[model samples]
Target: MAAEQQAPSILGFPHRPEWGAAAHRRAVAGYLRRCRDHARIGARQAARCIGTSESTLSRLETGLAPLKPVEVERLLDVYGVRDPAERQRITLLVAEATQPESWHPYAHAAPNSLRPLLAMEPAARRIISYEPQLVPGWLQTEEYAQIVIRATHPTLPAKEIDERVRLRRARIDMLRRRVDPPVLLAVMDSEVFRRQVGTPGVMYRQITYLLTLLEDLRYQLRLHIAPLSVGAAGAIGHPIVHLRFFAPEYLPDMVYLEQYEGAVYREKPSESERYLAVLNHLCGVATPADQTASLLRQALDTWR
Candidate 1:
């Protein structure tokens, strides 16, 4: 009897090299990494084939390094990727990655660790983002974000702080485009309102915004507040995000965990399953969607 084929080690995604027109930068970066792993080539070998250093190759695989079209071509050639459709898809990803971000200077303010997530957002079919600390970045208003920026980076220059705030604010629009946007189900800690951020005014406005969004007739957003009763029973202390692609075989779901110095992306099936289970538990314990708006209103009244 033949043994079952083991999943690819890199992205843990099913293989379909002949997929079409994948323009998402994150998807491309992931695809490239998987191809290299599928070919069983070491970083040194890839660097030699692509005329770059091992460190550079590592960064490219992690989506940290800026990728040029020619570089993608070189890497693909060395990885033995001969599929015409896959080549075109990767080439399109190169174009998308090289395009200028419209948010300009603000967009440039975010660190490399975060850039990949933003790139992935456009391509994600569904997103499950959890925050135990405070409001999720995408849902935060400018005033609330300003307070967060100051508190997080107390020593940052005023100009720089403003830039960071604008950058975060820009993230909201990234998900609001009328075109095909990913469905976001943000599960947050119940302490969000109870926890003081900047001032009562800021907290009030932010809560008000949350209330509005929950009531918004037009969004695929599912805002769930995990009640304080659940407490430590929830997932780990840190934040977690799981991103699923439209084409399941094209790129496996990725779990993103952010730390102080950097972030972690888990593509392995086992790791992703654990995170997904935690999120499901949190969702189960969280207030029902119908009651989320009411809870926000109660919190909003306290601010008033």
Candidate 2:
């Protein structure tokens, strides 16, 4: 008699409808790594089984290389993934990973480093952001974003500038209108209010917009102002965003550190924890969320 068939093991890849290509790639990479670990196979052995170099497999696992559906199937076989359901989910992830994201059109305007952050933003369950010099991008008003972009890229063509602004607006609308939007905890230095971006009217309007959003209960936004008196909360003079996803069982938290020219993505728990620690420190030093509205009103008075 034939041996009895075993029930398929469920490998939980992100099944969300809102997941973009980047998210799918992330899921695929994570799933592959986990599957290999479960099978107790070393990278060299697995790569040999799949007829690929260990370095090539390393790139696939790190999401630096595209994962084709055929390659996924071969890797699954090598990793002893016998469950059909698991295989199907992986196939779907591979398909999704190859698809274009909403920002694909404006890819020319966005730096390659920034693309991953844009892709991951929609999938985040909660976002903790600390901006030392400017308002967080997710919270910036259209006018404010335009002025900041123009100032940063003085030589950028007018048309490209417009495209970048539109991309920013689109991102804001998408996040704002989500059925289950990510909770946003944003900490900005008090110096951000003092550092003028555009005209006085622009600053006033931006502050008013921020106040309105702070009062609105629908957005799930918590705004904090790190007072000048705090005097260096140990967050370096850059922006840090730590994104937490809904599926902690399979997905790991990510930290995005934005530099002057590019950005870095921290996915390992050890690396992400350090940034999370810095964010926690900033949160502790910043004024409480309840007092944020009053601080904004005071800043508004300065513009007035």
Candidate 3:
């Protein structure tokens, strides 16, 4: 039962964001902390209650160790988390935790612990993202995605690129599966389209895809274009993603900073609010989502 999950996807390869399982792990870890803290219990005391060593409990709290379903139940009992609803909520995460992570296959490419992003993506009520370098992954067409991957990952073999592109496409498809798909507010710079990725044709097709998405009000996509005129006011050097959760207890609001080495997640209210502030500033200075289609069209025409 300790085996890591490798849930197969209809996309054929492991493309499902391994976030749900990761989310479950995070939820379990968080629930235990709250229970322990509220009861004014120490790790050693809690460990004694649950029949585990102090170090083991510490590892669990820090997310350094995986918890078995039995362990979760035991910990919950010991922590005085007797509320049935709370128990059930935690139990649901336990089942979710059992599902396999899809990123295990591509661990070679994305070595970072990005499972949190995947976990939160499906459950988020809204996603506010700012992309200054290129198009956001979710909005990219296959051709555009290939170009980005090839340029950034020059050393990657063709097979791996194909594998990732397929997985990414599957991730985009995933948005349709959620009962209430999160509202995606994506702000990107005009330079992303102005720059040549694969060829003029590739850029045109990408712009076309964005145009289609922009017109589809039903898709919950609000796309804003930050022109060169806006300068550094609307963007920083890296991509910023803010995830807002519906169930604050199980999942917390987060700010994700994409770095070349890996990803950084900020959860503290104070730290995350700073990123949110930047996003708000960008929105104020940039073109509205409703007006973005025309700018996209102009870029597409220039590419032609």
Candidate 4:
């Protein structure tokens, strides 16, 4: 006979603005602790009821370990938690825990859990990326990469920065893995291409590198330009990306947004729809891919 499953805890809560997954763990731990206290139960007693050791219970209660659904329900039932709202909330949390975490493995023990989502996405069907402040990491040249990495993380040790840069370069290898790689379309501000980021030499080489990639036939890459005029139409934002996953079974699109500390992967239909709208606006206003290629040639000429 198969073993029976425990009831799931309620889960739907707006994630915190910072430390998203970590914050969720802390909140669930706090809720569990309150339940225990209300029951007047000691750690050992709670542990016994949940089929775990006292140390395990203590770690979970202290928010040091991620909460599991079975453990949540077993403990809650033992504590006689009868609040329907709390029960519903715990149930929602359980569901969120089970949702596919695209970036969970790559994330450091710290707060950057968001990085894994994009890295783990089932290869995207199409990718639209725009960056105004810097060269996108996927297209950055090695020397340009070092300068940007060092500038952004002044406090980080030189060795650590080198390791990170190495990893960034390695990630680019993903572009050539498949027979038909994802279609890449990018738009950059005119000034972004003109400004020298690392050194005059690095800047010159990076521009040339971009030109070389434009001619790569194997990777269906397309480049576009969004001039300053388009900026007035609300085309300006942190490097925005719209990736469409080719999941034949699922009708919805997945969208991801990244910030300095973390990112959010939005699978909700509404969120996906909003990004689609933004992408349409940007694509319509930006210069065509062929024209952008000409502009890139012009920029390379100016650099020489």
lDDT of model 1, residue 261: 67
Candidate RMSDs in order: 4.9, 3.9, 7.9, 10.3
Q: Which candidate ranks first by lDDT, i.e. highest?
A: 2
Q: Arrange candidates, best lDDT first.
A: 2, 1, 3, 4
**153-242, model 1: which lDDT tens digit per residue?**
789888888888888877666457566667788998888789988889989999988877666624768888888788766646888999
Each candidate: what lDDT?
A: 0.74, 0.81, 0.74, 0.65
Question: Against the hidden reference, what TM-scores do the models get?
Answer: 0.78, 0.89, 0.85, 0.62
The local distance difference test score of model 4 is 0.65
lDDT of 2 by residue, 86-116 (tens): 8788777788888887578798777788888
* lDDT of each residue in 106-130, candidate 4, tens digit only: 3332135435344433345677777
Backbone clashes under 3 angstroms, per model = 0, 0, 3, 14
> How good is model 1 by TM-score?
0.78
| lDDT of prediction 1 | 0.74
Task: Put down candidate 3 lDDT per residue, 157-276, tens digits, no spaces.
Answer: 998888667656655654565565677889998888877888888888889988876776447788888888997695499999998865555566888888886789899888888888
Residue pairs that clash (backbone atoms under 3 angstroms), model 2: none
Better of 2 and 4 by TM-score: 2
- Candidate 4 lDDT for residue 179: 44
Q: What is the lDDT of residue 285 in candidate 1?
A: 87
